[model samples]
Target: MDVIGTSGLTKRFGRVTAVDHVDLRVPAGARFGLLGPNGSGKTTLVRMLLGLVHPTSGSVELLGRAMPRHGAEVLPRVGALVEGPSAWPHLSGPANLRLLDAAGPGGRRRDRRRRVQDALERVGLGGIDRRPVRAYSLGMRQRLGIAAALLRAPELLLLDEPTNGLDPRGIGEVRDLLIALNEAGTTVVLSSHLLTEVEALCTRVGVMDGGQLVLTEDLDVLRAPTGHVLVRTPDPAAVVPLLDGQVVGRSGDALVVRGDDAAALNARLVAAGVAVSELALQRRTLEQVVLGLTGTGSDRVDGGTT
Candidate 1:
């Protein structure tokens, strides 16, 4: 079953439309990445999914149940982190989590401590000190937020910019943890503008631009071989004419040729005395795919000065 589904979902605020008509589906056991830059509507869409924001038009179904109407029954099975993690400055990490768990549904009082500890451990705070939240670093606070989301051992996780405050190692650790959870049958949905993060962690991706969902596909399919080969040789000029129009692109000593077969391209280069040094099939990078499909991200601003 699709853990999350939306049909023509849209949200408007006065004169501004934060989320346009968007149809999204996240299948069970998928590491689905919701990708878009700031103001691209990713956050709005996520809020609607969790029933925190009412859509201006269209429908939403989460865990096979309608949102808001059935949110009482469905939200407990799902976990989420939006905007950022928030906690009382004077409270310890464990204390903050305990309070959140107690207030939320789907967690029993008897199991609260175990749940908090497991969640903290899952998020790499297994041995943390008894410091108040005000003393925690930005990364530590981010992890604490993630732990709160996992307190219920939810079946679905909706995380926005999950790696925002993390260092390289922390990012990798989080990525590994998400993968492990997905393997264990958890459907993880990560919403971020970081292309590299999504590429490394997600199996499926959906892109938003100008509040519209412009693309949705499996990561592998979007990165399918372009039927081209990337060749890097000391002598690129000599091989270009031999392959004629097959050489679609070149940079310095490198050439992109529509050879389809890497072996054939290598053999041909060898026969032509091209002195090949490197050769490989060229596949589209996630950045390339997203850039081609979307315009300038919303982060950039322009004003008339002339």
Candidate 2:
């Protein structure tokens, strides 16, 4: 079953349409990534799904229940960490989690302490239980926020830029944790400006542009080779004609051919007396795909619901 589904989902702030008429579905056990540059409406869409923002038009169903109407029933089963972490500076990490957990649903008096400690340990923040939150690093705070989200052992985790402020180590920690969670049957929907992070962690990806979902597909398919072959020969001028119209362009000392049969192309190159030095297929990276889809190199989208 689809853990999250929306139809004709849209949100407009006066003259600005933050989220366009978008239809989205996230199947159970999917490590889905929602990617877009600034103002592409990723955050707005997440908000609508969580019932944090009322959509201007359309319907939403999360965990098979209608949104807003059944949000109280459904949201308890979902965890979210959006717009960075917020905690009481004077309070210790464990204390902050205890407070947040108490306020959240499904925590019983007998299990609150043990649940909070387990969450802290899960996020790698258990060692600093006595330290004030103000002394914790940005990454620690982010992890604490994640622990808070996990306190209820949610089935779906909606994380927006969960690795935003972390160092390389912190980013790796979060990445590994999310991967482990997904492997254990939790569906994760990650929204982030980091395309590389999405590429590494998510099995499926959705690209948004101008507040519209431009593309959505499996990550492997999206990054698959485009059947374009790159050939490097001693004589580029001599090999150009042998490829017929398959020549896409020339890259410095090589010829780019749009063909699937690499062996045939190689044979033709050799038959034509073109000394082939290299024959390689070209593949597009996730970054390249995103750039081509958005037409803008901007990595981040600011303001407006994010």
Candidate 3:
């Protein structure tokens, strides 16, 4: 069964339709990633799923239960750390978790406390679980937010920019934590604008553009095409004419080439007496493909719009 499913999910904010007839399915135990620019409806969609926002039209189902009507049933089994950490600034880390556990449904015992301790240790905050949240670093606070979410022992976890304020080490720690969670049979849906981070962590990605889901595919399919090689030569002017591919860009003495075959170009460069210092495959980035698709490039959707 799909952990989360939405069909014809639509949401409108007065004049703007934030999400339009979007369809999505997150397989159980899958590390699904949502990608888009600001105001592209990623957060809006998540809000609707979490029952924080009402949809203008359409339907949503989570874990085989219809949403809004069944949200009460579904939410209890799910955990989330959305946007930013929401713990009380004055409360100690463990105290905040204890309060959340006490308030949640069926969470009335020492087992919840033990789970909180386990979560703190899992997120690398075991040593300072007694410290006040206000005194914690940005990364520590982020970890605490994660620990609070895990206190419920949820089957589905939703994380939105969970790495927002973290340093490099913290980011890696969170990434590894999510990966481990998924491996242990927890379904994860993470939303972020960081292409490299999504590429590294997500198995499948859904790309949103102008409030619409433009593309959804596996990570391997989204990788940039490897059709050419980058070459750094002593003299670019001498080698430009002899090269078969188009010169895409110039960085210092290096030239970015795009073509069907680069082996012939390399052989030609050697025969032409051009001393090549570096030769490497030029891979397109997710940003390049997304920019091209969103009409952010020179090529406009209609005639002469830009």
Clashes of each: 0, 2, 0
Best model per lDDT: 1
Candidate 3, residues 60-157, lDDT tens digits: the string is 88888988899878888998988778888898998998888888887768697798889899898888846678998888888988998898778999
- lDDT per residue for candidate 2 within 1-306, as digits (tens), equals 999999999899999998888989999999999998977899889888999999999999999999989988999899998888889999998899889888876679799889988998888877775879899888888998999889899999999999877898888888999999999999999998799899989999999988898898999898788899998877888877776788889967788999877888888878777888999778889989888898453544573331
- Lowest lDDT 10-residue stretch of candidate 1: 297-306
Candidate No. with top TM-score: 1
Regions of model 3 farther than 4 Å from truth: 106-108, 233-253, 257-277, 295-306
As a whole number from 0 to 100, the lDDT of residue 177 in candidate 1 is 92
Q: Please report, in order, the local distance difference test score of every candidate based on alpha carbons.
A: 0.92, 0.88, 0.84
Say which prediction, candidate 1 or candidate 2, comes out ahead on lDDT: 1
TM-score of 3: 0.82
* Model 2 TM-score on a 0 to 1 scale: 0.86
lDDT of 1 by residue, 1-306 (tens): 999999999999999999999999999999999987678899999999999999999999999999979999999899899989989989999999999998887678999989999999999998888899999999999999999889887899999999888999999999999999999989999999899999999999999988999999999999988898999999988987899799999999999898678998788789978898899988899988988888765544574321
**Which stretches of model 1 miss by more than 4 angstroms?**
271-273, 301-306
- Order the numbered candidates by lDDT, best leading: 1, 2, 3
